[model samples]
Target: MGRNTRKRRTPLATKIVAGAAALAVGGGGLVWANFYASAHEDHGGHNRTRSAGAQVATIDCPDVGQKIRDVPDRARGEVDGELATMDSQITDAYQRLATTRRAQAGDSQFVQNSILGPLKDRRKAIIDRIQLEINRAGGRADDNLDELAGCQGRPADQQQDGGGQNGGGQDDGQNGGDQNQDDNGNGVAGPVADDFIDINDVQPNSRNSRNGLAADGDGGSTGTFTTDCGVNENNLFNSDNLIAAPGVDNGAHHTHDYVGNQDNDAFSSDEDLANADTSCQNQGDKSTYYWPVLRLQDGTQEFDANDQGGGAEGNIGKILKPAQAELKFVGSQQGDVVAMPKFLRIITGDAKSFTNGDANANTSWSCSGFEDRQVTDKYPLCPEGSQVLRTTNFQSCWDGQNIDSANHRDHMAFVQEDGSCPEGFQAVPQLQVRLAYDIPTPTVENGQVQNPYAVDSFPEQLHKPITDHNDFINVMDENLMNEVVDCINRGEDCQ
Candidate 1:
């Protein structure tokens, strides 16, 4: 696995949180509608995933397959139509914002989103029907995670909302009270009321607050290269779709980016990567960087058929300007050299989704105006003048030569605790990204509460708690890449 690692070109898609869903799904443009549903046989393990056979391009999650079974054959067509429609509308919203001023609506632009949307009502109805199927399958709608059918590998898709897959180990979906309930045994009466994890509860433990998150806080000679990567307003919604590289775009359970080389994908080559124009300020820098798109939860925007999940979810949001991209390599006390590869593909934070515990949760929730008070996991509603922010850091340690690895991860390792490079690995300028939002909470369902304020994740990450993740495909010029490396080797900080 060390010297013989094969170069597997990994899509930014696979490296997220739990490998269950992200590893199994693929992305593309609007062409997903041409594919068939995923069919499953038994696959075992906590990380169980099924790649489509050479001939089949479909999302294959055994758990989601079970949930799909909940949809009666009679309703399958309708549900597909409904989901497809929602997808089209969501795509259109991003297309509109492609040229318009892109920004998360401010406080005045905020309001609780209603469960009324073409997709929501149908989605909820489908879930109801799915519950009936569960009963027929000898399962209950409110069945605890233990009783849920299929693999329990990835529980991320079920984060906040009460459902069969939430995995919070607390909620029973509907009846008998689970998730967040009082002594009386009823599901938490309201959405934001009991369901939202208090800000104070998770802030002290933020992964972003971890000692090595930024430049080595523990102290060491830091070789750094800083740049203002200019805010990127590209259509990153393609995260779950095919991008970053080519050929495999079908129906992604999640999203990923194909930055730098405009022609990246499963088919991209070194030449193609070296020739693309970048979205960054450096016209000479052809590096392509991408992550999941963050959309505004503006409820005023409405979709057809009362579906809040689609166009109602609002357009794709924007990455702030002054991107302040700093690629610094912290060396040991001796100030040993560490430089990253020019065209490395990096994914930081657990992009794959999971829930039910504090184990795999990677969130640094906090207010924009109050960065020092950053919290973790469940976010408390931001105070009046503040907004929420999500941060991501990509893998930086490099093996010095191979541009990529079979698993996509082994090529680059995170910096060591002492802020030194691993024995065989050098270092690259680290890429850290932060996204901000002013998401409004959801309305009280039926005068009580049900759903939590959720971020729009690609399908596999469906309706989960807000967790931030990102992907980077380094398509920098060979000369610039070497320059950064030289700057580091000389122990100098450069922009």
Candidate 2:
């Protein structure tokens, strides 16, 4: 298949700052609640305070949606609506926290009694509705749903625990990028100095070495199939996530750049997506591909700057269009790939990883010329002549039964270290997305950042790079899916 040529965004001069000048990053003040355990105990009337000099940072709530793994088909709609309500609750709570910083400084328990306590009560009610839906659908609701009700506040002086995951980076920040607390870029919502790292300092192949995920060059399908979906040049943008919050407007709470299917939104149904015109060159493929828009915190507000999913939610700045959006499917190393079921939805990476932990993180950031060195937590500061790259590999193993799951993830699994699907899971063509951007290099110095770049996220997630993610819904006709599998099994690259 012939590929369409695209004009890349003009390059910017990259500035390299010495590591010796790296600032000492303070704690990010994010919460850490468990899916089935309470991170705090409600004390009656008494105020609870942090250590002598500690300050409240952000609220972290155990993601109720991720915890509910057994939603019956009949109850999914109601459950999804309730879950979206919970997200909005958190967003509102975060907004209050950001605005009441002065009160928080005076009263340590202000966040608890005035903010978190109220938020918890609202979430508890929503969780009750979810439980009612599940029981009504003849599914046994988890008894511990109450545990996910309460959210905790993290302190600005307490740091996040470190881990050795593929996408995990030093939680305290590394290399350099000044942390500014003012109302500059996203203000308290983040991309804080700690969220960025100089790409030059990252070790080459560090991700593959840590996760034991290096591909083994053994047998099976060795071919590739590519789809040319223009890089959102049509300006398709929205904050509605039909997969997660169908029928709810602004469900994502963040703006997304869409490239494939034109009819995807909070109200788009399977039929709507199937009948939609696609940006892909092949008319048979109407798959929808999208992810949070990347923006430069240069103070230029885009159209949605005041809209719920944009600046109003702290996703402020001028949105940067991708220089290139490459969508391709590759064969498994250990087996022939099966055709994917149409309308199969897949979400890669955790969009709330800043507060949700790195367990579900699946994104990598790097410079075009230095792809070998990737970081999961920090936005890569690319060098001159190199563009920033965001890459994600979708799950390539299916359950062979369900195209969707309760949590939107249980139906698909990533390949094992040996490149084989888990038992009962079948190998399928892996969808790989690579997005590139060219923008002015951000200036980081003396505890301040000018013109920083960040991915849009939930108000509470703080625009952290670990929260970067991608979404896909395969709307391909049977013929296109079959061709993809055949191309991979035959060792031929087709676009």
Candidate 3:
């Protein structure tokens, strides 16, 4: 468990970046070396599979999970180098992120947006390097992150009690229920007719039962629309487009699905996005709605265990497009759907869920061909013809005013039992996203998959499959919103 304390970052970005350069050139040469050369090296060939009897155990303080002792020497050394340098820098930056000043007003927006997000990127990059080394070393990583260089994250129960002290344990955004439970714990359906099943729910018919439910309303005023954002192609082209808060040109922390605005980021003005080209088929509709990219991993992919670098470009390298992009929009439950303001940044889900075992990762998994079975703790190993599927739903009720909030979540609330917006907020178009993929069956060791599954995430994710979630933002043109309002107010079904 993590101790309750505020983590302070004393390292400057320049020092970390420069130190990273020095390490690449063998500057600190073993000065910070923490691991001894694995005795298992030269054991004949590379990619040697470990025997089921291979021993794995956690070392001491700072390190957390059960470490695999069968790693190759070269790969172990590579991972160690990153741990001493990049991982060290990442730890410092993460402390800075937890304590940084939030809320950008006017011109200060530049610094406010630039601060933590960049650190997030750097941390993710460093972690990606570690994951790659582990993959090359021929060892699967344990999701508990017990093998991290100096990071000692507390369990969720400890995190909740520790108040998220220095350099470990996130707040997890949980209330009432245990945040550590899968998929945010027993999900409460919002005002939508039939919301998708929470990915981590273990109950049977979790998917099928909900799929059959119909959205009911006064038959006028509000309407929901879903679109297909084609699966992403393999490329470094930035797609994590929140365009605000940690505003960068290419969606710095993670990539996203861009509908409008050729150039989008936190600094982008509504006019710029409205005038820019779009990737969406609705050319007249200059709106950007995006969440994290979902991917299917083969054993060869360098991954941490959870979806860390949420963007498709950086850590994931290239991602095979999902079978479909399930995008749904919602308006008021009883009144006419109102028009959304231009350049609205509405984020949902925890993009960093790749590293957590809390409610944020409350995921539900399934197989493409086998729809009846749904698993929560771990994804079902898809058969020869089936593909693994993942889905996440965001909160809907809003405070009726604030476009963005301090924590980015306080202003939003989930709909009540009847699908009505909470007392203080009116419903806008609720955005629920779904992603599909094809994955290879992982190697099982001691009754567990050895190769950690990675989402485009940072090195610390530990590759735990249970931790899965996403984020979102809505940047729509004024006219396009009017069309949405019109469709909802008049009960017209238009794509």
Candidate 4:
């Protein structure tokens, strides 16, 4: 556990643009356009993979899983396992980089020849196995996967906004300021002073007017249902992700705070989840909700301080429990919403947004009293007495059939700018989570940060707030799910 009294200070880089006027409405309901540079494409694949760098801070590889689509159901299990192995390969390679910092300083090509080269060879072998599994299952695997096997090193000083911090492509965002080594104090890299901005400096970005909808007898489902799931006061923490890497231990490479269903790990089957106990006050709602734990980068060491996903991997500090965890389900603005299928799983935001870009980034940060103002890529610096808030609005549109997908994202879709479900998709009750933390607000002065807070993340991600994400697996009982849908359709607020 982390001690609240621990005091540590981190330094920051110079400030960038306050906030970009990035939100706008077009024919769609609401549009958050790409205000910063996206991850490098043209790697001969769907997405680029990033790695640990020397002067180059990290590695960059191809995200093979994102490109491997339409696999036969029988092959998905083996393919998923191979994907997990690839992630492990990267983690191991990153460890090599961190430990050999001395060698990296002396040898210019040490990272490329010794670290990245070996990782690529390992990844190539795994990519072959993934393709074989799909082919054996009678699915046509893409031949270009081999091209993605090659990984490159990123310059530590190379600045471009993607992971977190910045709407206007600024090199100052997260380039580690003037420090040459990881100043985050944790053994790993990132959350440099450049990664944050004062919340009060951010201008208001307009959202949909219908977002604050009330029960006015509109065409849409105007009601809401709130579930009382106590914050993980039971201390349910783990680094496993059953949805993305089933049967794999420490797949996430970072610890998560789990709430709702008590039995949620890499091995929990749908049946196991249905029968598990829940933290929610309502026994009928056994859904599992989890997210990366937020930690203050103080000197206090927690349980995982020496573990792979914890301090060993550079995610040190004390874990802070949320002061308030409010889970509410609301209806679609277009029409009445249907009940979500049981066992439905949704992952909001990208855990690799730092390297993968903001295409899938959906996080929001604000101060408790300044809820009207929100920032997606930066952590909010709340005013004194005002707590920090992290909010996530899950995708409300379902593909109508599958409860999950190959990439764990294809089954669900966010409502379009017009606030309507896409063609062939059904609008489901949208889950909105508001998590508030009562930790001391971090302050930056003279290029130094005092008591900073960050979400646990993959070592290479550098604890970027944009990489913060959430997970949910709906296991609500049929009767209770019906009650939720009915309540929303009726425009009544029921808890």
What do the candidate models score in CA lDDT, each in turn? Answer: 0.39, 0.73, 0.40, 0.72
Per-residue lDDT of model 3, residues 205-307, tens digit only:
7542221112365653556665544454322234323322332222333334443345444344555555766665666655555444443332223221112
Model 4 clash number? 27
Tens-digit lDDT track for model 4 on 1-495? 011122222211111111212222221111112211122213243422111222455565567887777788777777888998898787667656545544554465777788888898999999999889999999999998898887766544454455432221121123422343335333336566766778778888643333333223367899999999999989988887878877667778888999999987777778778888999999999999999999987767577665656665666678999999999999987889998998898998888776666767777888988888888778888888998999888888899998888788888988766778789999999898899999787777665566788998887776788888989989999999999999999889999
Please identify which of the two predictions, 2 or 4, would achieve the higher TM-score against the true structure.
2
Better model by TM-score: candidate 1 vs candidate 4: 4
Best by TM-score: 2
Off by over 4 Å in 3: 1-152, 155-202, 206-223, 233-236, 239-245, 248-261, 265-267, 294-318, 331-336, 354-364, 369-377, 443-453, 465-467
lDDT, candidate 2, residue 339?
A: 90
Candidate 2 or 1, higher TM-score: 2
Give the Cα error of residue 49 in candidate 1, in Å.
Answer: 34
lDDT tens string, model 2, 310-386? 76666767899999989988888786888999888888888878767787888889998898999988888777888
